[model samples]
Target: MIEVEGVKIDTRHWIGGERVASTRSFPDISPIDERHLGDLDAAGAAEVDQAVTAARAAFPAWAALGPTGRGAILRRVADGIDERREDLARVETRDNGSLLRSHRRGVMPRVAMNFRFFADYAEKLAHPGMEVRGHRERITYDPAGVTAIITPWNAPLMLATWRIGPALAAGNTVVLKPPEWAPLTASLLADIAHEAGLPAGVLNVVQGTGAEAGAPLTRHPGINRLSFTGSVPTAGVIAAAAAPNVVPLSFELGGKSPLLIFADADLDLAVDLAVEQFDNAGQVCLGAFRLLVQEPIAEEFTARVVERARALVQGDPRDERTDVSALISRPHFERVRGFVDRALADGARALLGGGPNTSLNGLYYSPTILADARPGSEILTEEVFGPVLTVQTFADEDEGVRMANETRFGLAATLVTGSAEKAERVSEKLSAGTVWVNCFFVRDLGAPFGGNGKSGIGREGGTYSFDFYCDVKNTVFSPAGWRES
Candidate 1:
């Protein structure tokens, strides 16, 4: 057991409702200061097969419990999460270098909300019923057995439960493979669910790298459905692995999402949202790291945004005053810095931070802004996935919309405009899965959420979530005594 912020956590693979003994382990390093937290027990192919076998054996009984029965247990899991919210939040912050306050106030609560909201929705789910030409049709959703959920590291627990909640609610057994970088909270959650009386093997967590554990899980023939949120390249590999079994796959991949500021927009709100790109040190998959502004207000808006970006505090993530913290690791920090270095070398001007934070130490890249970035520059088009912002100006509404829709990624976008008409008009043209108007990161649990093209393959939220986690079956019958042909 390893203790983080007074919370004792088990860092091991949770399979078959118990912590499995490890043949090998990987070091868990804290991004906060590069300290060794613990050694996480790694699960190889054998352990993954054990998990799948367990899940398959338990699937029938778990699914026998209808949505109402499943929901009752899920609510208890939510209660357990609420009870340990602070402990989970503190461990997540220590593991991932995200803001402690944000984790406490927002992320951890959302984790609990993910379970509770999906539980309520599953209990109240209504399938379509219709009658035509004296024939009645009843549509039913049956749980897809043995779902494999692979989540990213940025927002570990919240994203994991975002998929896990619906899968479990729909009465499907799950084998979750969390990113190796931040895998501790998942172990904590497995304990919470077990303590809440979740059936054995109903929810299993296999902890290891993609190659060792995740690859096996994806390829396991028992997985009826697979949901993954990560890089597009990695998604491709998972797709190929799951192809032989013909598994149903859902992906929420990378994003170079745009934040478009129209001329009629509120400058202060736009500026604030622009600086929000630095949130989580820009590790967020949906962050609008690319800033496109209308030429009329680009100068004023850019100035205000740069001033605000400069004022952003960069320090220990545990500090309440700190706004930005370290990147996930030294390699990620170097990758982010490399993007800025190349952009500057290619003549993109740095309006604010240009490189690592010299004042502070350990993987802290200053919140960077590179203005006058060439249209097709790598910095302008690619995902930095760090606290680096690239600025570009558009002449008019047509150009603004065109620029915003230029990226291959359609994960999300933010549009700041005062006029509802323009908000309606411009949002329609942007090719993103979700669009925010006059705000950023405002989410509704019921909304259909996913991306188009390379960003992702399918949506997951509310009924959309159930749609992925369950299979639909249509039952048609002749009305009254009508005879079938």
Candidate 2:
């Protein structure tokens, strides 16, 4: 909790291993009921600069710890997360309106697992050198000084740790700028990091609007690497800011990914997997927004999908029975509603839901399905980022693959087919960063995860993250008799 001008708020940013307050504050409202949850301190240029300076000062010592030492600290952090899992999950639910059940059972567990995976990987990591004809060369990896990590409002803690775990494991100091809408959990994470014995100034959290905090952090010359997860337009802005300093960036942006359901797919399995589009209220970057069903079974597949979507429970996010929750804010809720309204206006047919669920208060939109949506419509081509699915039909395998790859965004794609050969062939042709065969959200912690084209910039997760957060330098040692020319 924080106090500003004699008023108390529920959250505060952590910088230099201490709770910090800002002069200006922003209202933190609950999407479930629009109630005032708290006042979040607004971190601007000054705060961002302070956090970066602290990280920059802390980098040398953190890097000197070596991978094993750093891994040990990370392991403790992982354990700390597990110890506070329930508290963390509840904070996340209150901040972002994600269903408490999902947060506890799914998101929070993944957060701890991510830290543990990276910690173990860091200890086992090897940067082997080679023996050349006349010299022995050694390859080494070093942290990239200060890394500025910006995460979105959806799944705040899980996504932030996705970058935080690997960056810290590789020994880079970080300044994390969590979304203002969901800043609570990031602060909690900072507390946990400190309690786990993370060195002072090793990790900092700055909270504010994108213009004030995010833009300055991205453009700060002190930062060595920039890692961001958000929309495509925002990524472009971040890229421009980082350009002047030549700061390398790893972007995990938005997607309108496709799910290809072949004629031979198991109908039950296919429908279940496709319904994952509504998980986290469809705010997931990897959620399948475009469904391409084979023409032969398109009707049956769409019917089942609609039925399942309709059956999903929609109510208070805290309720264990609720399957779907409200959007993060009123503006975002309206924006998602606008996408559906425009689609319907442009001649798209809503097979299930199309607009806000006025029956209930707050920001709730029904799980929507638009059948026979025009290929070029806004809803079909753009990322709705809501509980909405726009579906189309493909005649055969060739057409299915073609249509799946048609979108500019290629973050993730799904192929539901019984034949292994067809799955392999189509997976190869799909231009997505990750392809799931007969699965929806099953992710391997060690696998490379990112998108191609507008979806994202670089890969993360596993050793791939180590590549982004560190610099690999080769040291050459000539034979004892050799001399420099």
Quick one: best TM-score, which candidate? 1
Q: How do the residues 1-485 of candidate 2 rate in per-residue lDDT, one tens digit apiece?
A: 74322333346678888888899988887788887777889999999999999998899999999988988888899899999888887777877999999888888988988788998988887767798897889887788899899999998999999999999989999999999888888877887889999998999999999998999999999999899999999999999999999999999999989999999999999999889889989988999889899989999999889988899998888899999999999999999999999889888999988988878767999889998777777888899899999889999889889899888998999999999999989999999999999998778989999999899998988878888998977899987875689
Give every collision pair in model 1.
Answer: none
| Model 1: residue 260 alpha-carbon error in angstroms | 0.9
User: What's each prediction's TM-score?
Assistant: 0.98, 0.96
The lDDT, on a scale of 0 to 1, for candidate 1 is: 0.92
The C-alpha stretches of model 1 lying farther than 4 A from their native spots are 480-485
lDDT of 1 by residue, 342-369 (tens): 9999999999989889988788988989
Whole-model lDDT per candidate: 0.92, 0.89
Error of 2 at 57 (Å): 1.2
Off by over 4 Å in 2: 2-10, 480-485
